[model samples]
Target: MTSSTPSSPLLPAFGVGTFRLKDQVAIDSVRNALDLGYRAIDTAQIYGNEAAVGQAIADSGVPRGELFITTKVWTEHLAGDKLIPSLKDSLTKLRTDHVDLTLIHWPSPGGAVPVAEFMGALAEARALGLTRQIGVSNFNIALLREAIAAVGAGAIATHQIELHPYLQNHAVAEFARSQGIHTTSYMTLAYGKVLADPVVQAIAQAHGATPAQVALAWALQLGYAVIPSSTQRDHLASNLKARQLRLSDTDLAQIAALDRGERLVNPEGLAPAWD
Candidate 1:
């Protein structure tokens, strides 16, 4: 795969995420997101819904070239020999030969797989045309450093992380930015938690937007790509409008003050040492 120009955005500024969405529900959600003008879709091997997402993509009637699909390789498949084959399986399930970007879903539990092994394998997968770009998710500053060392900064495309107002993760985001690795904010709405925050709601009311839109806009304005998932058509459509909702300086500062380092996705045995 060819490298992207430096000026090109690493990923879509706004996209749809498919976590916990399954079966026909995943299909209808993806299909509806497409109809509402969402071009980027995020999924994972562990999500167990790639086939459903694939079916939705197939039935959407949208040309493949117009879409940007991203999927992750589970930690169990990080071995050098296993990575590519596993990604191939993901491709078959996603109904595509190549994904726009492929990421290490999380660091190997307890560091069982060395960073070089999986990063090199991911690089190989990109070279083999299985994915156009490669990246890592849920990595802290130290892990990001190790990932950059393993793959070289230029080989990395982005760092997908849990970055909502409540869990700003400034250290990791700052490190990624300093190295030119774009940050993709997952759970930008904080699993609906931020949607109910008084500050977020106030900002939304002031902008005539929903709290979800305000949250997404805050992340986008900070130059981090956001994937906010929704199963509702109205919510999906409203989320996309965030690209048009520009927050004022006060609004941005107010949301920034809401950061409390509250992380919502840490699995006891799987989470890394956060930065």
Candidate 2:
């Protein structure tokens, strides 16, 4: 149950995300990611893949001390009584005593659960050594303010959101920066939509990197942590190499221009009033 320092750096610039991968797919993907030198692995209760991810980690033989594992509390578990227990279940399924980072998957659906209730519980989880850090994902400016009020900004580790070349999410990103909260860019590739963008492809050709790398590097250059997922080892390896891909100012600007606020992860009735 021991964890790294609370003030340890924000998530690594690169990691593997297990959003939809399940069963053997999840296990193999996580195993490949670790084999390719990836230490940070992101999973969530809603993904239905925690067990598989756990199995992969156990099989990887990588030291737990060397990994940064992140999991999110699903909406149904936001209640004060359920938050910690649900996280304990996640720990069990993840086959670990404590995760490096834990996030509120989304703001309680329909505001049915107050931010104070769940955030307080999440903070309590950290105090109890159930998790090393706590954060919120898919929180807009208004929700971020409420969360900060519930728990100081310092306790809110990162605001993970759907961000990419097509949907820059400038408003939320800017707001999080002002409050000193880090942002993690999920779907940074826009679910492969951005990879086909002619601009991105051209940039990739110029750098001799894959389009996926170009997208990831752009986000990383913006100081946001990225967790792109893949089932193939070659693709996984190529994506990890994005950490070393440096984009020119011109490349950044071109990609910036591609932003049209094209968000792809919004769910009906569950989405917050976005910024």
TM-score of each model, in listed order? 0.96, 0.96
Tens-place lDDT digits, model 1, residues 28-122: 99999999999999999999999999999999999999999999999899998999999999999999999999999999999899998999999
lDDT tens per residue, model 2, 185-221: 9999898998899999999999999999999989888
How high is the CA lDDT of each candidate model? 0.90, 0.91
Each model's number of backbone clashes? Answer: 0, 0
lDDT accuracy of residue 19 in candidate 1: 97
Total colliding residue pairs, candidate 2: 0
For candidate 2, the lDDT comes to 0.91
Instruction: Show where candidate 2 strays beyond 4 Å.
Output: 1-8
Q: Name every residue pair that clashes in candidate 2.
A: none
Q: What is the lDDT of residue 53 in candidate 2?
A: 96
